[model samples]
Target: MAAEISSDLLARFAAIVGAKYAISDINDQQPYLKEWRDRYHGRTPLVLLPGSVEEVSAILKLADETGTSIVPQGGNTGLVGGQVPHATGNELLVSLKRLDKVRAADPDSNTLDVEAGVTLQRVQEAADGVGRFFPLSLPSEGSCTIGGNIGTNAGGTGVIAYGNTRDLILGLEVVLPGGRIWHGMRHLRKDNTGYDLRNLFIGAEGTLGIVTAAVVKIFPKPRSVGTAFIGVDSPADALNLLHEARANGGGTVTAFELMPRLGIDFVVRHVSDARDPIAEKYPWYVLLEVSTQSEEGVGDALEGMLMAAYEKGYAGDAVIASSLEQAADFWRLREQLSETQKFEGGSIKHDVSVPIRLVPAFLDKAIAAVEAFIPGCRPLPFGHLGDGNIHFNVSQPVGGDKKEFLAKWEATNEVVHAIVAEFHGSISAEHGIGQAKRALLPGVKDPVEMEMMRAIKATLDPKGIMNPGKVL
Candidate 1:
């Protein structure tokens, strides 16, 4: 039962956080009400910026008692509408930006206890300050918070070597639905618990609970980093090159990204200081990376592997970065691929994953299916080839109207997702199924798993006050 907000209840909330922090003016809370992509615009009765964990608990207690829904948000850089509130204008939006803190950093243990509100880039710098590495590299790291990363279990270019955010997390400090704080922040390497409750909140998309703080694992800074650009005939050759590099490099391979010639052209035209590393253009391109803890001859090893690949006809043309500056520039081209698409036209995108071995087939079949639907539609599929996850995006045909192109979003999604299903792949790979994909969940999710998710939601949040209308 949804209860109407009374003047008395609003006053109580205002008193908990002081008048300044409890924002009610539309202009004051506009940034919090709108998502980063502007896809989902929400209205809230009040936006509460809690400064501490205890304050968060108190706000939740009041909401639970009054039957008011609470939506927890961090940097609000999410793609799936996970951080935005509903359009009802009745829910309370809880912003956690004030809780940013670095509680501890232990170089000996290679671990850091950081608050949820800390930005991902700040976390990386803190690790680098201590001469350690925090390899959760993403394009949005400058704005995305650690809590949002853990909530969505974010995966970026580094996942090929370091895995996703879930793999780097050792433990968490979460605030449960009913206003109780669960402090399970331990630095233990091995703990055989009955059930790993910490993982339950991870990738839950803030449905299970709000992660307040966490203790995350860190790695030693690689002494040597090498990057290379290779042109391939097809996705099959990209896969073969990946296998060869890993076998020869012996686990030092960190990234293997796939991009089409069209995507590279977009970057070169739109992005500043972007140029092709090689003179000749192939149908497909791959930016591969290798990192090693030892200072000895890592670049030599990478060049040697690429030479073998070229001799065996796996690579058409190639360029290995001769210096760290060149390596960074090479990666910048791959990282900005998605950003460059906006200038071309509206894009219908899918972040999906399949078995590593089946990726080549998935790409071929998906491209064929999409072209059949909309002729001349530029299929810009790229990202994390080593992990079998690709940001499969379709840019509108040349000289097409942006609005008209986006009007067929649903049709494009169906065609692409159908191919994903055929390969036994996930519809939402690294990004969670937020409000954007809520309607499509039942069609793809197993009935038994859906029921279990609902059951857990009911048990933990019977009143449905935590992030309502999301991921259900």
Candidate 2:
């Protein structure tokens, strides 16, 4: 239960962050209200931009006392509606962008302390500045913040080499519901203490608390790199190529992406200067990258692997990047796959993951099911094939009504998701279960596991003032 947000109550929240920091105007709050996908839009009475942990603490303390609902937002680039407030305009939106700061950087220990508001690109740049590498790369790295990454345990292209945000995080600084600061930002990697409390909030989706800062691990930068774009007959060949890549690189393969010809066509048609890496357009393509600490045999390894793959009929035409610029161009095509799909029309996207061996089967069945259900919908599937996550997106047919096509979103999801479940895959892989998939969680998750999650939420936030109606 939460209290009604009156003008005076809003004024009280504004006093903590000062008038300049408080955003009461509806127009100013619009940007924070909607998600990037434009699928979930919400309204809030006030949006607070707090500059310090103490300010965050004070806001939460007062919120707890007043029984006010608090929705924590970072970067506002989240696909899920977890960052957005309810349409009732009663919850308070606390934006962490002002808390941007690199508190510490130690290349010697290969770790850095960053506030929640620091963008992922800035973190990568900071790591590079310190002669290290932070491998949590994302397409929205320019705007997505550390807090949001931690909230969702975000997975990106580098997830195959480096794990998700949970694996990179050493510890997190969180503000509990009653404004109590949990100073758990320890940099030590081998602290086998009592309970592993650091992970409790990593993928909690802000239902338990607000993450204000984190100590994350950095890695040694690779001295040599090899990137390639290969044409494959189908997802099965792509999977076989992935097997050859791993066997050839032997722990050096960083990314193996699967992109359909339709996705590449969308990118080429919509994105300027986006050209196919291979002149011959195959049904499926793979963007493969491998890196090593030494510069000796990366190129030779990639060349030999492709040669073997060609002999086995796993790959058709291939182009290994000879220059860094060419490698970037190859990546640009893969990264722009989702962004350019909008030009095709309304897209129903699914971030699902299956076991690596079952990727081809899952895609085959899911694609067939969606096409049969929607008749003329374009199935554009692509993502990190090395790690088993696929961005299975379906674009509406030519001259189709966008609204009408989108209206079948739920029904279409049922068609695709049913196959995913048959394969023991996850419905929401990288993206957290925000409002979009909140209702679907119970059907997919174990009953006991769901109950345990609810008990933890109630234990941490008894009043349920933290991001209500979000992930249970």
Candidate 3:
């Protein structure tokens, strides 16, 4: 049974978090309820924007005592319905947007102590100000919060080198259900302690608890950088170029992306400031980059790698950015690949990851499958090629009905995921399974793993009031 969030209960919430922050007005709560894809429209009787960890603890404590489910939300930029509430309006929404504060920046330790609501961009800027880099680069960095990133274990373009949010996290401070605060925010790199409680909440999607704050890893700012967009005949050829790039530059290979001709066309047509870096259109392309913390030879190394790939026939042609502005322009094409497709109509998207070597074959098989499923469908596969994570998206064909094309989302997902499973790839690569992939979880995840996850959830959140309908 759903706990009734009565007027008296709302009053109590207001008392705990303050009246102005406990927003009950439907108009004021729209942003908290809606999300990026416009798929999940949920209802919440009250939206609580707690400003402090103490306030969040108080809210969680009260909800646990009252048996009210809490949907802990960050910036609400999550693709899955993890950040959104259920349609029943039975759950209470808790927004951590007001918790936007960088508590400390320890340059010696190479770590930044930041609150959950701190936007990813702000954290980056703060790191830059201190002559350091927090390299969690993504399209949604401007709006996505680090807390939300932690919740989903987000992996952006930097995953080729720095790694996912989980890897970048040094420590965490979480607010468990029933209001107990777990202050495991140690900045130490070596902690051979018992079970890692910090990791439990890192990718839990709020089903476990609310991440109040985090201690994130930081690095010395790179001094030199190089960017290139290569024209390739096939995904196989792209992988070849990847090997060359890695052999020459190794760890300097920061972001390596596989973009299809269709994706490039979409970016050129839809995005105003962006243009095709490689003038001639090839069947496929790879937007790649290399960088070094030492300024002397990074650019020359990148140029030599690109030249070698071209000579080997792995690359048809390439464009090496002469200046930082041009490099940004090259990356602009990769960054807007996903958003530009919105102009094309409904898209059936998949965020899957396979073995580095199997990526080419995976793409070939998946592309053929989707095209066969729906003739005239445009298979736009593009993403972090270095990490083997591809955002393989299918755009509705010309003169196709938008609703009808979107209706095939589930079927298309199954088609692609079945092939993904054959190669031992992850179905939910970066996007955490909220409502969108909740049903698909049991089929994809191991039975033993599922049981273990259930046991943990049951143990920690015995009342099952923490984001009631999300994750497991």
Candidate 4:
């Protein structure tokens, strides 16, 4: 055990949940310490599994009284290190897995009240069970929890239509620094009572408070769905196709994903049963889906849009999925793009966003810059082109030392992020600024904006016991 945590202190905290729930053994704590990408590893003297909101409140209350730092984790699938504790072993790790429960499901109101530990897939299932749809569809939905999604304001393929997590959530139940519970879970569409408090914690990433439960909005299930994979000449061509789809899709264009041939190559090589949707290889590809309430013309609308785009020289080749299985197959290729990159070697990832119109220009400049900086590196730039969130990932050169290439993570970020700044893009788009980008936050954020954020942090967490060394 670390010198900072006394035996008495550990036991005192353990007693709140139970001896069985408080995990102090290093082996048991290992899973909660390291992030998925292995980018950040931390150490904690104790990991508390809080089963109830009262237990979480009690833990935070005691931590506040003793000036102990607390790191709250949900699902342990965070790409960034925000959920992990620090290496000093002075902080306490609070896992919300035990809090998993669907508190309420009101199909009439089109909302579900769930605890923070509920997996995103479970939320979707709950919505589907009630003949509704919760459209936050991330590749990690099977493991990532609702709290983590709201904590990061996660965006996925459905963002073009349904919006980010912030837009999907109606209200939140938060536990403040001193163990005070803020019961702000309202199920109203338009509430003009006072200041919007839920928005503050939506993307705060557990620094302000722990989201115990939430009321999330759900939409009517689409009556019909149309999926298509199209080959494009470049990012510019994809943008043109997106414009045409938007004008003709009648607001049914739910997803417009931009992927490169390199990403497709990686997926097809690494994933079993994965194959290219298009017969011919193109510089870029688009995975477009149209979902609508009207089943009559959904397929025809999508086909008409694609046909018009093809005639206008926007799409080179296209394949409209005729069956549900084929559509799932196409989605599998897009979803596996990130996981398959590991097979090639080290990958430096950048999640950035710019104005919709500036995407092509930004991609051209950033890709050229990264390629020039690291010769022979494979850049796999792909993501939601409609919403302007690009996952600009670069794999290490063939037969290159993984460690040597990963050592350039910071330098590569500087090169790419500099171009992002030129296009007025955000350095961190859907992913929150965890430990990975904490230092870089200042350079990208405006001075006044940084000052305001710091002030908010100080006011909410004066002792700085809530998730230290994160966000602000």
> In order, what lDDT does every prediction score?
0.89, 0.92, 0.90, 0.92
| Two-way lDDT contest, 1 vs 4, winner | 4
> Candidate 4 at residue 184, lDDT?
90
| TM agreement with the true structure for every prediction | 0.98, 0.98, 0.98, 0.98
lDDT of 4 by residue, 1-472 (tens): 2239788988999999999999989998899999989888999889999999999999999998888899999988887799998889899999988888999999999999999999999999999999999999988889999999999999999999999999999999999999999999999999999888899998888999899999999999998888899999999999999989888964478999999999999999998899888779999999999887886787788888888998999998898899999999999999999999999999999999999999999999988898899999999999999999999999999999999999999999999999999999999889998888999999999999999898989998999988989887
The sequence of per-residue lDDT tens digits that candidate 1 reaches over residues 1-472 is 3556787898898888889899999998998988766789998889998888888888888888888888899889899998998887888888888889988999899999999999999999999989899999889999899999999999999899899999999999988887899999999989997889888889888887788999998889988887899999989899999989998853388899999999899999998899899899999999998888888787778778888888888888888888888888888889889888899988888999999889999999998888888888889999889999989999999998889888888999999898899899999989888898999999999999999989989998888889988999
Model 4: how far residue 232 lies from native, Å: 0.4
Determine which window of 10 residues in candidate 1 has minimal summed lDDT: 1-10
lDDT accuracy of residue 266 in candidate 3: 92
Q: State candidate 2's TM-score.
A: 0.98
TM-score-superior candidate, 1 or 2 = 2
Q: Tens digit of lDDT per residue, candidate 2, span 64-160?
A: 9999999999998888799999888789999999999999999988999999999999999999998999999999999999999999999999998
Cα deviation at 259, candidate 1, in Å, is 0.9
| Local lDDT at 159 for model 1 | 92
Runs with alpha carbons beyond 4 Å of true place in candidate 2: 1-3
